[model samples]
Target: MTATFFQRLGAVVILLWLAVGLAACSNFVKGGDNRHNIPLSGGVIQGLRNMGSSPGQGMVVRIFKEESVLEVWKATGAGAYRLFKTYEICAYSGDLGPKFKEGDRQSPEGFYTITPGLMNPRSNYYLAFNTGFPNKFDRVHGRTGSDLMVHGDCSSRGCYAMTDAGIAEIYALAREAFKGGNTSFQLQIFPFRMTTANLAKHATSPHLDFWKDIKEGYDYFEMTRTPPVWDVCEKQYIFNPAGSAPLNAAGPCPATVSNPALTAKLQADEADLANKAEAARVAAEKKAAEEAALKERGAAVNNFFSGIGSGIGGIFGGQGRPEAQTGTTTTLPTPSTQRP
Candidate 1:
């Protein structure tokens, strides 16, 4: 059978991942630590160590909901990022894609910090990274939630999960970030990991309004590597400093308007996801039927084979032959006398 389009797209992602891993291998050879526990996730990883990134130095995490990918980057110098690594986040509870309100159990979408002392050394999983959500920013906005973390596990209603091996590398990086004092850095979560192309594609999403707020935060990262300031009190996105970008604006920024082309692209992508869901369902049903049929066929085949073997042995003439006597006397005395 021909490969489904979604499967092909998944293949492309795998290839891109391979390329990214190759690129990052160079970085690891030069500056990254090799002693840290490596995770099954193949993304490149590095520790900050005691080496501090200057006040201006920081990192950005972009989580893609559709792909379940988290791309991490660190500021190389002024405005450039050294693409450090990418992680596969396994969030299965499809319902919790977007954060709706407090206690939603949904992975949050917005600005957060990587606070100090955020490490969970005793995690049931292999390792974890503490994403300081609902920090001062979240609480000020009345977005109450807790224990937001990225860790390993095949299961979760709304957390970023990974295999045990995947978490080891992440843990090492988190430790490095902590020791490097990059723990006070910023984190930006979106409904899906945002890309300019992806944003344009998802432009008309039913969740666009919520995404709009997210975009504003994303724009800040695009412009500055830092996470944007969120005014929880006003319940609006603050782009410039607290005093600069007022909540009430006289007019709209030209670039703030939604782009139709981008929206169309995102719509097309969503359509593809729907297709994938359908195909997966059908494939599952087909597999179940095949397994049931195989079980019945196997029983019949085994019975036939056994019967055939027994019939063949019976026909071979050994069954009707007389058995040898267990016992007694032989006439070897006459032969012995002749020999003597």
Candidate 2:
């Protein structure tokens, strides 16, 4: 009797909690935490130490929508950033596409710059940072949206949501980096892993062209392990442009200059990815063709057996063919016709 009572009470508690959470605007609505005051966990700090990095080093963030993951990278003594940690996204709104307007409920995918001012220690989600949506490229295209964020609460309102524990650690890292004098960090959000194979797989999607365009920046970071100094030109992302003159977002791009070694390496890598995609496409086509041929052979064999059965039926059933069958049968009276 006591156990049953306890079980009933437990169920009631869970129901009440879920009801309250679901009632909120985002479950991230209008609340806060003391978690931000805490420092990075010992485990995270040790991992940074393993990479010869400290908590206060420069940091960059990356988010992958399809994968539902976020990565935090830290600058190492080698002067290049290394992957520091990864967190699972608890929730995000909309499908895998860029946000176009306010209240679209779409999580954005693009480059954003986050400064200390963008960080929110008192966010309703516990900890949050603005994603700076509708960036230069978005503006050039006349896309509209605002207040996009990566935050804690395990729920989202067109935001990247992480568990409270996860965001606590992430927030601490950014705080320490700011104390170490880093002005701002880059946040790169992608539709997916941004591999050539993935692009090829999504070739039929309407967003392919846009993805290819952002891929230039993606390729650069993959090669250098550093966020490129990027800007908008011709309404697309351009990295490491040579001059300081402001670019016209809708105008032609200016000349770019980058490390020759890096350029060569990236070109070679791209070629390899392209080759792999092409090979996959060709293999898929070949498999489809083989399947079609197999299907055709099966059909022919079935038809052959069916025809034999029909012939046998006609001979045994006293009918020349299905169409020749009549309800009444006439006897063969050849003598009368011959005499006539």
Candidate 3:
């Protein structure tokens, strides 16, 4: 049961190749999840859908603070979402958990959508992703929070904040949503409190009702792993299995958000982010180049002065004459006895 010499050599070579392949794989996977530059966009891409110039298609967004992730998913057809992409929220508020009502100063838990599109375009902040809150669900379930958005306010009062660069990518995803027919999308902003560990930690709060609703939403997400539809007027969540109830006399439960003016505002906000990003990038590069040149010039000046010093020292010390120096040098004689 002895193998031929050639056969053994082939086996050894194959083993070496396999080892090399595995090492390469290990290295490649080192930054596996983090390595993806993820295009300046977020979520899964489906070519079946196209983004039109207007934002009217149904958009669904999920914010998992626990994961520090915000994903944009676009509804292509019935029961189908082409995930636009995911973005990292650089900073979050208070505890890493869902917001409960007004003044909690925490990011709200449960489903909500953008109401008015108005944004301070001239904001000194990087950029804002305004999620119209207090939609039917928040009001009905009696949750509260307003002016909630994903913005460049790196420090958040109640909104999710990302860095200027992070918001730039988010702006793109939001714009794409509008263009792809997503006039409005749900924004589910929860703290990192959705974990089983987290739920157990806050299990005994007097505000347990609020947390209970959030947990329901979170569990629905865990089971079906889907965003809930905001039952506009009811101000509560009509879980998918529960089905949507008939609208009351209040002009449709989830008041249809027909704010064209708001849509325009969102578009403007997005444009502003794109412009600022480009400008900042250009300025940074210019500054870097200028700094480099200054360093080089400074070095050249130091070398020139050093050479002059050497020439002068040489003259008085019986070294090479100044004129024999390879680099340029100048000398000035000491003033003769001042005025005679």
Candidate 4:
């Protein structure tokens, strides 16, 4: 099959990004636990305290792909997590949403657990941590991938890549949390911020239903200011279930999310999203109408000049220029077909 211009252009851009990412990864110094032992900087420690959190309390990592933001939230004395820092993601591959399969080049989306064992100090790309892709939701949905990581060196094939310095601090925070006896932490990845407006913007995506399913967990965390206990049932995310019963990914969902406040919040967001979508539609139509009107006016002006040029040519017995350029249109003579 022949590739269209846009497809060819996209392939070229992807290759270029891969080249740069590989070069950046190669520049990083690897094979050392010493760098992993680097402590949190003074400014970071101070920033944590300002948010009522201290190093090693606990942490949750959230990534928003479209926004290119990775946020670190630490458990505060109040037991609720508070935003500690937001890091700019230097690189990530593929489009928004979950990875479909191995070598798909997509960075996975959805909830994951990052345990101590997932951390890698000797990573070829500075420090790194596996994202534990193909989590229950992915498995239930038959998704596949491996070695999905949040790593340094601004490189990514199917990973989230951060700058060396940015990831150093992020890795340090994770280390501190593990030292504080945390066996694992939640890693939530979203396509975007999941606001009502953002959802409205993507309401027509093929992944909208999937996104809405994940947004349940997102809403729970937003309302509670803590990671929601998540599990997969019936191939979708179920949050804060009531029972202690073990869940089967392929089986029917045994329990549903139980937060009334969050439910109310979601309902409101849906309503607001409808309004936002309508407003956006109207705005787009208005813009299109204005552009069409402008185009018509420009054409009228061009035709007026063209008529004048034709009249002048006729009056001057072809002494006027053979062609008349008007706006974006040029008039030319048709070849004679009466020759014997």
Candidate 5:
């Protein structure tokens, strides 16, 4: 009956209530109509169904830093992913390169995964999910950083920021995926679209090789329309349709079976890329040869003129220059020579 006892009881009740709220927010039921009070809008639900995606299904996220775009792809009943939506990124930090260390202000560019446990429903940025940075590849290279995220508020400091409305839709999509029994979803971040043209444009960048490695995964998804089974080995990425053998973060890559379809696609792509590169190289060489020939011709013409001029000068005993310089000159009167 004392006031102190009443206050303690009230504190316990408040703590319990908070715990329950958080639990509810984190736990989502498959095909559930409500989401811890923040139910999906009718429009969003309708949109998903219209796109042939159910309320709860698997999803994948792809981010392109150069374009400042995020694409959401949802799995269809046919076992392939279809593009669900594309959201413009409000802001992201750093330039087109992977985050190397803490305080680099660089947004990470690599394969990351978002799990149900990583969701932050009580985010200060309205809503967010941890990017799971410093992944195996990052750590293998001794890279360091932390707390990178995709969130709202349209501001960034080594994170991907989106509008509050954008985050709401994204968060809901992820929640539904989890509810549908997807424990985790892939998040593939890239410096730009991994096209042959784009790669060639940045051929001289220091990250070219790294980009090429990531492009394998990108191309796999593009071709199969499914998230590629990826694994990291000896600081490199390995992908296959059958998934990789228990990958070691720093150990050698286990022998993996190549999917025949993927192999054929990659081989064809490589041939195309090689042809493009060779053509570029040949064109550069031709340009250099033409420029060199033009310069040689120019030098020869100048030499011929010099020979003719030399002969004329020699016949005149080099006297024309002195004659040309013999014009009358007026000297100013010095102060001492002037009439005072």
Candidate 6:
């Protein structure tokens, strides 16, 4: 065979090989066995069943930024949620506040819902789901941002990032919840556990009012292990489990009654929180008073010593002066003897 003919054949063979390799890489990127496939661990499944929950049941997600914790709660057969798991966040971007605009790099803090459509199994980050930001409350306040996500890969730009293994289990749980006939699952993100102490500690923050607004929802959930039906009205979050009329995001809130027992409990809790805060404030004031008194005493002692030192120096200086010499005679000036 001619050398030129052999070269051309080799080039064709190389091109074919390249094409095959590209196709394989593409398939791998698209996921070989992991694409849209969520395999729950046997332990997880068994645990769920033991907790009176099944694979396909309603679920709720709660994230606390300060603690870097994500809690997954699943619905039991009794129509209440039980803590399924707590996953430590690998990373998250931004400080503790609501995301206001695009490119702010703020991971949002608020109530969000995730539907099946938000799932991105083919995510380059291993797995991900968008947190529906700019919801009713955000829109009412003219806040804007998009594609905020809880994703794997342990990196974040403006998202909550988890380890690949962590996200895999989270994704599986969420997917099963959807498959179990839930149209959506609630995801509540908070700066921290909305405890009375935390709120008081951050009482001077600019976001305090907003935090108080969200605390209502938090309190409701704590009182009853069920997700409160929440709606936005008058640019605020309104939660009512007693079935209120549909709310308009920009309109004023309508009057609604919450569960009476829960309401009472919440009121009592609030009163107790107020008492604790007041006690803390009083104690802090007392401490300040004591410290000020101590400082004042110290200053007085320092001033007294300083004055004594000055007086002693004056006495010694006077003793050392020519005027105070014990054995010296004074010379008087004579009358003028020369003409000026």
What C-alpha lDDT do the candidate models reach, one value each? 0.59, 0.85, 0.58, 0.88, 0.85, 0.87
Model 5: CA > 4 A from native:
1-37, 241-245, 278-340
Q: How would you order the candidates by lDDT, starting with the best? A: 4, 6, 2, 5, 1, 3
Better structure of 2 and 3 per lDDT: 2
Considering TM-score, where higher is better, how would the candidates rank from best to worst? 4, 6, 5, 2, 1, 3
Off by over 4 Å in 2: 1-33, 94-97, 287-340
TM-score of each: 0.50, 0.72, 0.47, 0.77, 0.73, 0.76
Candidate 5 Cα lDDT to native: 0.85
Ten contiguous residues minimizing lDDT sum, candidate 4: 318-327
Q: Encode model 4's per-residue lDDT on 11-117: one tens digit a residue.
A: 99999999999876654446323798898889989988998888879899999999899999999989999988899999999998779999999999999999998
| Model 4 residue 296 lDDT score | 100
RMSD in order of candidates: 22.8, 12.6, 25.5, 17.3, 8.6, 8.0
Alpha carbon deviation, residue 204, candidate 2 (Å): 3.5
Runs with alpha carbons beyond 4 Å of true place in candidate 4 = 1-33, 42-52, 318-340
Tens digit of per-residue lDDT, candidate 1, span 1-340? 3579889999999999999998777554234444343432322322332222332356666766677777676666455554566788766334424554556768776666666567665555545667776654455455666666777776765577777666666565555555665646566667665554555555546765556556656655654555555543344454443354433332333223344544565566556655654666577789999999999999999999999999887766554543323244444544354544
TM-score of 5: 0.73
Put down candidate 6 lDDT per residue, 1-340, tens digits, no spaces: 5999999999999999999998876675366656457589899999999999998999999999999999999999999899999999999999988899999999999898788988888788988999998788998899889889999999998999999999999999988888888999999999999987887776557997898788888888887899878898888888872455678788877766647876776677678667876787788899999999999999999999999999999888877776675567678988998899
lDDT of 2 by residue, 1-340 (tens): 9999999999999999988887663433345335666877788889999998998899999999999999999999999999988999999999877888888899998888899888877687888888988789899999988778899999898999999889988888999999888999999999998887787776657886788777877878887898888889988988889988879999999889858876775577568767876787798899999999999999999999999999897787774454457666567755554543
What's model 6's lDDT at 179? 84
Best-matching candidate per lDDT: 4
